[model samples]
Target: MRSLFFFAPLLRPHVKRFALALLLALVTLVAGTALLGVSGWFLTATALAGAVSFNLFAPSATVRGLSFIRILARYFEKLVGHNATLKLLSTIRQWLFGALFPRLPLPDRSLRHGDLVSRLTADVDALDEIVLLAIGPLIAALVLGGAMTAILFALLPEAGWIYLSSLLAAAIALPALLIGVTRGTGAALVEAAASLRAHVLDAIAGQDDIVLFGRKDHTAIRFAEAGETLSRLRRRQAFATSLAAAAVTALTGLAFLATLYFGLSAFQAGTLSGPILAGLVFGVMGSFEATNAIIRSVGKLGEASASAERLHAIATLPSAIREPLRPVALPEGTGIAFEGVSFAYPDGETVLDGIDLTIAPGEHIAIGGPSGAGKSTLLALLLRLRDPQHGRIAIAGADIRDVGLADLHARVALLSQDSPVFFDTVRNNLSLARPEATDAELFAALKTARLDDTIRALPRGLDTVIGETGTTLSTGQLRRLCLARTLLAPAAIVALDEPTAGLDRETELAFLNDLPQALANRTVILVTHAALPPELALRTLTLAHGKLEATV
Candidate 1:
């Protein structure tokens, strides 16, 4: 229940619409039971009246009015209820995305992409059941059931007691039974469903490797096994729901029979009219329609709870870097200095130790070393993706931690080896860097990266759709496009991590020759293992054994 309250803030904005929806649902349920009870009484009363000068006008008019009310109220009720639910879902999804976006370079790679996809899509989708299936129906049942009890009590006290007790028992006991019997099954189904999605997505994403390695049969068998497991879990949940439905139906019959027995006694004692007795009995029977919702919803309570817990866990994960409570303004210059900066990973491996370095404004420097020499780690620290454990990094005199992340990012742009290109049009992908950039600016950046001609030769030029992760483009083209994206950013600092990683020597040197022109006044931090081309005259530094030293 505490987990469910996490959405309280999100629901506040739409409280009015949500309340109206619930009220409509209550009115619809009341109209349904009232229509049933009144029809029973009208039918019985008319027969009695016919035996002694029947007055059909009043009963006929009342019945017709109720029938129209029932039809119209039910129609509007469904419309409003569904609209509120959809709006709530939209709010929840937006909130979930906002919570997860800042934690981008997730600390753990083992938390597979497929699993996150499951949480973002399927798990978030399950939250709708909380409002629509559980809370809404439960409230309507209570309100309508109470009104029915009051009407029955006025007609016959004994009949009212029987109806109220039976309805309450079915509402309470049946749901309790459903939760007890199906909680584990609900949790199991959710787990199996998520795992199955992960395996299927992983399999599809790696289909090429599986086929090339002749492990297609092995992959197929694993996929089938996962499908079978999910199928079995779903079947268990279905069976439990069916069982609860059957139990609720039986309880409905028992409540009706008990009401009739007491109602007949009242008729014999001359305390209740025949029509009134019949009306009370039918009202008792029809009220269980609300209880049916409670029954099915309880069966899935465990699933909703599990989903809520998962969302809460993700929303509360510790950020790899912390922001300041009172952020100071960014300083005038973009020149960066790392003072006594040291960082160690969770596994106790020190990636950067006692590092002190400074790059002046508009200076171009290349950092070269073998793998695991902390070149990339330095770039990460400079970008503030991860904060140093022991020291402060300042930009132009103020600590980077004192500066707002957005302001810092606006001043520094990174172009890395594994930079992502989305499955979108070339213009849309490039626009991600600067959404308000003009066409001329975009083309200029592309030309500086030497990718303009490649895009121009394409059938749609900037509007062409690149496949997922730029699969349609060659490795060199993808890297160049990423560099172009970096160039589009209006930043004073550009950090390139192996920018020419996959290009041939000739192409790498050509791009190197163009770098100075593209980044004329920006402070540049180039991290690469390759030797710098002498023509570029870049200051060279080599990081070895956790210390920085100048190279030839």
Candidate 2:
């Protein structure tokens, strides 16, 4: 029930369309049942009149009018319902993606990319059932069924009671029974779907490792196991759905029998005319069609509930770094100061301890440390990706926590080893820094990062598409592409984390030799294990065992 609240705001703006669609559905179903009753009653009355004194024109016109109305009503009903459904689906996709974007930086392993993708695509898709299947059907069934019962009651009271009782059973009690039967199954199905998706992704991502370790067979078996588990859950859910449908059908059939029995008795007593008697019988049969959606939707409620719960869990995650209530504007300087900065992971291992450091505007500093010495953590903190457990980090004499997030990000740029090179046009990837950047600016950034030659050699130059994860580019090219993107930003401060990693000695040395000239006047923090070049004017610092030591 709580999970359904996640869609409150998402569905609010589209409520008008939803209401219109439901109205159209009710009209379509009601018109269909009325057409059936009218045809039955008219044909019987016309046949009787033909034997006495024929008047065919009026009855023929009425049947034609009802037929046309029925056809138009059904066509428009489908059009409106489908249009609203598609629009709602588009909005939900956008909303869910926006909500999940900022939460991607979770370093604590609380979320997985595969699972997130599943939630965004599969889980979000499941929510459509709430609108199309559940709510829309419930409204149509109640309105149409109630109105038909009232009409029957005016004509034949006993038949009306039977119709109302059976409707109540099908529309209300049967749905409850269906929901109870499939209550836990929905959650289980959702979990199984997510797990299957994760397992398939893991197998694909680790295919190389699996092949090398002779575990390919084992991986295949595990994937099959996941599929089998999903299959079994779906089978149980389908069975429950079928059972619910059977119950509704049986109830509807019983209502038809009761109406026929009562209609015959009323006709014999001269309380109801022959035409009206046939109308009541056919009306009861036709009225049950409106409840078809109710039967189908009852089973789906459980699945939608599970999807909602999964999506809500991700949407409500608290930010890792809390934003200030009133953030100060960043000053017009690049100097950074870390005052008694200390940090520890969620597992309580201290990564950085009381580290104090400062760099003046336009200064370049290189940091060196062994693995696990928290060198990269320093870059993360400086960028405000995570707040330190203690102490303050300030940029341009203002605490980062007190600076607007967008402003702080604009002032500092990071080119890390793990930065992604997306599968897109060369120009488009570089333009991520500044979308409005001109071609000349892109070329300039490319030249600065020494990647212009590679782009020029490509078939389409900047317009050429890079394959997935930039696999089309060489290792060195990919690295330079990421560097080019970072350098394209108009940031006052730049943090390069192992910037030249994975490059050959000559390429690495060449880039390092030209680094100072390329980044002239920018405050730089370079985290690397390489020895500093003699020509560059840099203050070098080494970190060991969670402590920083300066080396001249």
Candidate 3:
């Protein structure tokens, strides 16, 4: 419940829309109660006074006006309510994305991709009940119930106590009971749904591997178990909601009977006329409409509370890296220095130990080593994706820690070993690094990466939409496309990890031969096992057992 209050700040911007929607909803309920009351009184009076004696014109006109107002108010109420809810959801998604950026490379690697997706999509969607189902409806019910009780007390004193007690029981006590009964089940239902979604996504992503390994049946059984768990929790929540609804119905019936009994006694004593008693009774029944909505949706209030807690938990997580209070400007020059740098993973596996190295501006160097030798970790430290546990890295004689992350990132660009080729057009993929780059500039980058010819051969050329992870392109072409993106970044220092991985031997050799010229004035740090041509005139180093050694 406390977590649900986290959204109050976000609700401020949309207050006007929400207030107007609430106003329209109240008008709709009030007009509906009046319509039912007037129609009951008009029909009885007309039957008693015959066609000529009764004044049908005034009562009929009043009923028609109330009905018209109810219809218009109901329509606008739905319109404004849904519009405001959707706009608020849009704002939340934007806020979540904004909150997510700085916390990238989240410390907790155990958080699966699918579970995160569920929180962002399904959990966020559930919050709509906060306004549409829970808050707005609850407010409307209270206002209508209070107004109806006041009218009964003023006109039909004997029945007012019965009506007020019944309204309080239905609107307040019943929903509270429902929430208490269903809270745990509601939260479990949300978790079970997210788990099921994660299993489905995992199966879809690993379908090929499952089939190849002959584990399809095992995977299917796992999925079935998750589905069953979700179904069981849903059934529990539904059963609780049904019981609450039944209680509300029973309460409504008893209240109606009691109000009618008291009203009849008053009429017998000549304190209340038949037409007025009928109107009051019908009004009492009409007022319970608000309670019905509140009862039916109380279960979702539990679900919304659980969803808010999950979202709040994720948004408030401690960031993996903290920005400095006052950042120093990156000095001129692209030279990089690693002075006695050492790093270890959270599991205490030392990747780099007491490593000292330096590269002058515009120098091209290649680092080679066996797998798991920490060549990649060095690059990550330089980019400040993860700071070293010991010593410091400097750029142009200034400690990189003192420089702003954005400034340091702009000064250096990296094409990692697992760099992704997004599901987008050839032009769009390349333009990610430089959105305002010209078609000519894009073609130049693609040509340098030796992918322009393949793209040109396609019917749509740069406009061709690639499949997910570039499934439409050959593995080598995909690698080259990602390479072109990295090359397009306007940075003085560029790091490429296994950039020529999927290229054939011929293409690999050709790319390496032309690499120096393609990156003429930029400092290049290449981490690969590929043999470099002597003509490239680049220094070569090797990393082994957490130490850097000059290659002969």
Candidate 4:
């Protein structure tokens, strides 16, 4: 109920169409049942008249006219129902995508490829059936049930009473039995789906390592287990769904028998005509099918409720970083000050304590720290990925929180130590920093990053398609490309984290050789364990055991 209730706003735009479709279905039921009753009477009257040598005088054209009405009603009613459902699907898809966008930055890092894909695609597929499976049939059953009872009451009240009572019993039992059966399956299915996604992604991402370590068989076993587990869940859900459907069918069949047994007795007592007797059976069949539709709808609500809960969980994640509601503009000149800044993760064991620092615009500073000394954490705060738990970090004498997030990011271009290389062409990867950069500019950055020779030697030069995560490129080449990308960015403030971490001696010298030309005129903050090379004016700061002290 909670999840289904939350989903109402998503359906607001299509409510009019939904209501129209329901009305059309009502018109269809009334017209269809009435046509069946009228045609039966017309046939019987024509037959009796003919037996008296006057059948040729009966109006056969009346039955033909009513048959056409049934055809038109069904066709248009189905059209309206399908059209309304299609519109609702489009709205639901938009909501799912829109709800997840704001949470992407600090997204569940634990999230894997398959899990995201399933939520975006497969979960949506489940919902398409839910619309009709829940509401449409419920309304259809009520309308048809009441209509049949009204007709039956006029013919023989006892027969109508017996049949309607049984129909009502099925309606009440169908949902209650289903709720008991599928009570615990939804949460389990959701977890199983997520786990399968994670396992598949893990196997693919580690394919290279798996082959080298001779662990392919191990991964296969794990994947098989995950697949089998999810399969069992699906089978159980399906079994429960089938069982409920079967129960409804059996109950409706009994109602039909009860109507027939009692109707025959009424006809012998002259309480019901021959045409009315046949009409009662026709009405019961029409009525029960509508009732059965309602029964199936109850099972569908479980699925919708489950999906809605998952989607809501994603939408409600507290934003990791909160920007100022009334954002201050970025000031001129890029000086930064870290004033008595102290930090820790959520549990509160310190990562950086009592840290303080300042750097003027265009001043190149290298921050050297032992491992786990808060070097990367400091840089992350400077880039505003996470704010300090205590103390203030001001940029150009204005607190970073006071500035709009977009403006702060635009002011600082982060060249992360991991310096991830996307598996795009050399030119395409380089152009991410400045999308309008020309071919000549790209070649210039390539030369400065020492990747010009490698690009030229390739068969397609800059158009080479580096495989996934730069698997086709060496570590040194990947780092140089990452540096080249940062060179093309238009920010005065650039922060580099261990840019030379995995480089060879020759590659290291080449990177430093072109470093000045690439880093010229910018306020650069370099995170490295070693000293800055001789080519740049520099200051040094050291952080050790979560404490910072100037060591220039």
Residue pairs clashing in model 2 are: none
Residue range 1-552, candidate 3, lDDT tens digits: 788788888889999999999899889988998898888888877887787988778899999999999999999999999999999999998988888878777677778989899999999999884776776667877888888888788877667788788888988998999989888988888898889999989999999999999999999899999999989988888888888788878877876787789888888999888888788878888888888888777888888889888888788887877788899999999899999999999989999999999999999999999999999889988988888999999999989899999999999999876898878888899999999999999999989988889999988999999998788888777877887888899988999888878778877887778678778799999999888877778899999999999999
Residues 1-552, model 1: lDDT tens digits: 467788788888878877777777677777788778887888888787774686777777877887787788778867876787788889888988888778766676567888888888888777774665777777877788888778777766666777777777777777877788787777777778888899889889998999899999998888888889889988888888898888778878877887788788878989888988777777777788888988877877878877777788787777767778999999789788999999887778998899999889999999998899899989999888988889888899989888889999999999998899999999999999999988888899999988999999988999999999798888778988988999999889999999888888887887788889888889999998766788888888999878888996
lDDT of each: 0.83, 0.85, 0.87, 0.76
Backbone clashes in model 2: 0
After superposition, candidate 4 runs with Cα above 4 Å error: 20-125, 208-225, 325-327, 347-350, 366-375, 415-490, 497-519, 527-544, 547-552
For candidate 4, the lDDT comes to 0.76
TM-score of each: 0.86, 0.90, 0.92, 0.76
Encode model 4's per-residue lDDT on 482-541: one tens digit a residue.
888998888889998888887777777676666667888888888887555676556778
Candidate 3 clash pair list: none
Q: Per lDDT, what order, best first?
A: 3, 2, 1, 4
State the lDDT of candidate 2 residue by residue for 95-122, as single tens digits: 8778766765755365677787788889
Q: Tell me the RMSD of model 3 versus the true structure.
A: 2.6
The candidate scoring highest on lDDT is 3
Give the worst 10-residue stretch by lDDT in candidate 2.
Answer: 101-110
Worst 10 residues of 4 by lDDT: 54-63
Query: Top model by TM-score, which number?
Result: 3
Q: What lDDT score goes with residue 108 in model 3?
A: 71
